[model samples]
Target: MTSADTWIAAAKARADKRAKEGKVNIGTYTGNVKADDVIFSEVVKPSGHKAYDDAVKTIRSVQQAGFVVPPSAAAAEFTKAWQDAGNRVLLGERKPADAMKQAQQQAQQAIDEATQ
Candidate 1:
């Protein structure tokens, strides 16, 4: 089978296992993809901008590292930084590079704070 087919098979197997574990299938499964309860609960969409996306990814990584919770001060600050930069870019108030740089700096600050 092709790589794509193999992946789909693996996903199906996982879905079956989850089902056996009493996980409800919240969505239907198509031929190529499965839309189970767990899959449906995840936030998988991109923010359409690299800076915001990277900021979010950084925050998630830090949280996963057990440094902060979703509603923690550090997480809020990092999110605010990215959102501010994204809003500036969207409003044409700043260049994309400038916004990205600001967002990155803010993310770094958050990371430093969490690490310390």
Candidate 2:
């Protein structure tokens, strides 16, 4: 299934399970649903999962630091060119210098095209 479909299915499953349990307490600071059970707070106390907690901490830290950057078309083009060059080098198709020079040229061309 698609990403959105998978997400919806997972969410519906969670909701169904919670409803079956008869205690639904969904936490979300971004939501606007005013309710007695729904917690609208910045800190959604740890879930006890190390990996998930770490990811949440990192996301909250980045959000607090205002480090989130908007997507850039030029950066995407440059990254694709850079990855192609690295792949070519890895496959023994081109020398490192030649691959990098070509990558740079492609990225520069993308920038030029974007500006024009």
Candidate 3:
């Protein structure tokens, strides 16, 4: 019999047996509706369950010079760093590069005053 037919037969058997015994709770006897519940072979396996060998190979390649990280977390870090720098500038913290340029302008102003 097919899976469903097998399940129907099992259910009927459970109900019949329960009725004979006058057992009102038939839920427990209805367990294992599938006739062929053995051998849990994976059809596609769970996603993200990477093999150990595959992980080792990927790690080794990441250490190589010619390795490519396509759309990786490195891109996210770079974007975050750029945003942090812009935020530091906005927070009025003394930015060294900007301070250096301002100092150079002030020195030039002093030099222009001295020359004039």
Q: List model 2 lDDT by residue over 28-81, tens digit each.
A: 322122321133232144556677567755654454344322366687888888
Q: Which regions of candidate 2 are displaced past 4 Å? A: 1-71
Clash number by candidate, in order:
0, 0, 0
Looking at candidate 3, the ten consecutive residues that score lowest on lDDT are 36-45
Residue 14's lDDT within candidate 1 is 61
Where does model 3 exceed 4 Å of error? 28-116
TM-score of every model versus the real structure: 0.40, 0.40, 0.22
How high is the CA lDDT of each candidate model?
Answer: 0.60, 0.60, 0.44
| Candidate 1 vs. true structure, TM-score | 0.40
Candidate 1 off by > 4 Å: 1-73
lDDT, candidate 2, at 82: 86
Residue pairs with colliding backbones in model 1 are none
lDDT of 3: 0.44
Tens digits of per-residue lDDT, candidate 1, 1-116, equal 43444545555666576567865332222332333222323423343667755764565445434433356557877888888999999999999999989998988899789879
